[model samples]
Target: MKPGTLRVWSQVHTWSSLASTAFLLILCLTGLPLIFHDEIDALGKAHKIEQWDEAQLVPLDHAVDVALAKRPGEVPIYLSFDEDRPVVNITSGRSADVPEAEMGFQPIDRRGAVAAGGGQTGGVTDFLLDLHKDLLLGQGGMYFIGLVGLLFVAATVSGIVLYAPFARKAGFAKVRRAKAPRIGWLDWHNLVGGVTLAWALVVGLTGTINTLADPITAWWRADALAHLTSGEGGAVQPYRSGLVQKAVANAMAKAPGMRPQFVAFPGSPFSSGDHYAVFLQGATPLTKKLLTPVMVDARTGEVDAIAPMPWYMKGLLLAQPLHFGDYGGLAMKLVWTLLDLAMIWLLGTGLYLWLGRIRKRAR
Candidate 1:
């Protein structure tokens, strides 16, 4: 690149970082708690069933029935499996994901359901996730952060362009403690940012991709959902959940002892007809994250097809675990968390440097 081009890139890097620093700071702050969300949630009080074995597992529908028996008007909103417990959560509510803002999530177990431990899912962890994903603003907040992520990428590329010239003046680690305040801050910003480049860019890009989840999923449903139709329509109208229930049962019968990772309901652009879209996880490490979904016909409750994920959708699915870093152990989590904090530090110093330069010019 020419000297002029490098200078222009540097200007962009400086201004872009300055423009989004505050929001980015909030993201980093909230992101910290989420890094340890699993660990933190584990610290809480738990209900241990001494005899969950019952010699065998009970039908999930039975558990759902138990939950509904407790909350009459409520419908099953979420049925989450415990990562390390025999507890099954049956959250009942309206079609809208979260129940009313006032009456939050209600967890259910095998024997019965109860309104227990409803003080912000993971306390600080939930706070951070909400703030980071949507800034507690719901969908709008998520998009805004996604846009910030886009700008972050642009700024990262521009920063690298600027780095080439900056390196001409000094070595990679040449931080001068006695330099002018602007120079000192800039050095620190670059120091932290440079080392964290790979992680930051990956996090920013993947996070941005996650932001487009609603749309991407819609697109997938539009295209792939039809794939389930077998060149026919009218099988789904109003999307009865029972159709999905029937379909899931059919798929499970065919899967032969395979466990369900998650299920997509019908009429949801995410699902077709009433047939349930069931994803089965591989029992092996190499294929655990890889899933093959079985499509069941909504009306007939019969198996439609058991197929591999579309290449694009499969890539997206795999990217999720990689981005979150939850696939690995504590050491991996710590590394990701530390890098996240490094991003926070880099953002802080970069903002300080940008402001310092502005004040200098003003003086």
Candidate 2:
């Protein structure tokens, strides 16, 4: 790189890193626990359901009815089945458009109409996840975090550009321990940053993409839903029936070799006012994260359309598990944890070096 170009890249690296350092620190701290969120959640004593014959499983409609009986005046928003056990988890709220905070969740045994667990939400892990996701500021916070992720990416790229020149001068991974403290820290930062560059870039870019989830969903709904419901009338009509179970069955019949991951009731965000959107997933690990939506006519309980997610929506779906290292099982999560720790160290040392420079300038 030319001298002027190198100087510009150096300044870019410095400012971008400085701008996002604090938020990045918070993300690292919160994200570490979240990397093992499944394991941590497993630590809780779960209500065990005895194995039951699949043929004897209770109907989905019955399960929803049983769940709604517990929460009076509430309506079912979503119904999801457990892959490992004969249990159905139902989410209910005052209305379809109610806030998540107003929603209630219940796990019901499919073998028998039994409440498997108490309705609960908001725990330590959820708190950490919320903080890691959006700083608890909802949509606006997500946009802010997305901006920070962009800055982090900028820092990473600029650092890589600057590292080429530094490596040629100082040799790769050379930590000048005998030099001044700031110099030593700077050397350590460069070395560690270089070592973790690829992982950092992947996480930063995916995190940024993940932050656009709401808008992406909105776009998918606006475009895909419009296309799917074009002939049925532009406006969503009020659904007439409550054949939730039949709708799911119809969707499954339409999508052979796929299993229902979740069902979005009519008038819900994931469904039109006249259809039940049953999201299906494949049996494999990777495909489990990638969902296909099957829209069933709520009034007639017949298949309306089978809509595969758009490329961008699929990207968002795939990016989520990749961002969290959830697709590769425990081994990958361990690798993610170690990488997260290294990132924390890099952020800390970078901050230390920047402050040291500021102090010297003051003197």
Point to the candidate with the largest TM-score: 2
Candidate 2, residue 239: Cα displacement in angstroms equals: 6.7
- Per-residue C-alpha lDDT of model 2 across residues 1-363, encoded as one tens digit per residue: 789999999899999999999999999999999998877776766745557787898888888889889998888888888866888999988887688888889999888889986445677899998899899999899899999999999999999898897788778999788878777788788898999998899899999999999889888887897577553533444433358879888888887899999998876788777778899998887777889998887778888888788999999998888789887888999999999999999998888887888998999
The C-alpha TM-scores of every prediction are 0.83, 0.94
Candidate 1 per-residue lDDT, tens place, 333-359, comes to 899889888888888777767677789
Question: Model 1 Cα displacement at 59 (Å)?
Answer: 1.9
Question: What is the Cα-based lDDT of residue 330 in candidate 1?
Answer: 85
